[model samples]
Target: MNPLAHLRPALDAGLVELGLAAPALSARLLDYLALLDRWNRAYNLTAIRDPREMVVKHLLDSLAMAPFVGDETLADLGTGPGLPGIPLALARPGLRVTLVESNGKKARFLREAVRRLGLANARVAGCRAEALDEPGAYDCLTARALGTLAELVRVGGHLLKPGGRLLAMKGLAPADEIAALPPDWHASAVHALRVPGLDAERHLVVVTRRAA
Candidate 1:
């Protein structure tokens, strides 16, 4: 029996709250969480150790971005342990996701997760966002706790095709970071996200290149 099985109710409730209730998807999310829990004991891939907290902070928090996602090729830059990338892929099977991570251990974990989860639409980049060579290849890019808006664009901007958007998950509204955005890019929209079971504030900053 999976030790994390007890948290299934919480995960299901959170998914229903997010309007993403699906039995299969929720089960897969739990499987990924169990895998992460197992790996953390040996790799320390993430700091959040409790499985219940992982359902809220990791699974629900990541799936909260589902409504904002579209059917486009997405690159998840600096995806430590495949937060939004993995969950988003699991939620929307048609959306193609590329998990970009430079850390060797984390990258290994990501690849394993993708394979074990049978994520046919997801792949791992296993390189730094800036080092990733597929220029102007993606329709959108996502980052969670990666860096400031400016810093994120500086590193991963090349991955976006023309008119592509960057959906950045941040804690609180990063006004300072928004103001620091490069001249070529602008915050097209800012959405305050409410993750079920989470008490803190979360925001999604959508950025796009300036019209030439």
Candidate 2:
């Protein structure tokens, strides 16, 4: 049986559970997985070698945060292989997604993925998060397994609009990291995400700046 044929049902079932039952979006997500699997062979973008694990860990894990993303424009900091950003863009065509990756090879892969996927709403930024000087530019900012909560805010805080939120995807609830957040920032909410087919603990931390 074809690899995609084996993966399609799982992806479809996962998407439906996530309330993202659009056929077109599901196809794009599978295409992205194929691209990532191909590139991982050469670039070693992700350590997980099995495509089945990729479906659950990469695709479904990222899509789990889709419901929390309500911003028109989103910036994905340290987006290696465009995990959640690309998938999110596929799910929400109207969302403007900027994928920021400092690695040249990963950045190139991201550019190619965007081109190949025909994701007109997504773009790649080959630079570090702190280097991005666009203050209050995006309505929401996202980072998946990128860094601690404090570090993420310190680096990408400027990219968020005044009332925007930072959606950080983590394996477990980082209570210490949340407590260490800067005085100006506050933890608005922490949502426990139940990614389909993934048994690990998944959490989405929503952070915002304190009002003056």
TM-score for candidate 1, residues paired by index = 0.98
Candidate 2 residue pairs that clash:
none
- Per-residue lDDT of model 1, residues 1-212, tens digit only: 66788999999999999999999988899999999999999999999999899999999999999998878899999999998999999998889999999999999999999999999999999889999999999999999998899999999999999999999999989999999999999999999999999999999999999999
In model 2, what is the error at residue 79, expressed in angstroms?
0.6
Per-residue error for 58 in candidate 1, Å, reads 0.4
lDDT of 2 by residue, 1-212 (tens): 23465788889999999999987887788888888898999999999989989989999899999998763999999999998899999988888999999999999999999999999999999999999878889999999978899999999999988899999998889899999999999899999999999889999999999999
For every model shown, what is its TM-score relative to the native structure? 0.98, 0.97
Model 2 / residue 57 / CA error / Å: 0.4
Worst 10 residues of 2 by lDDT: 1-10
CA lDDT scores, all candidates in order: 0.94, 0.91
Error of 2 at 136 (Å): 1.2
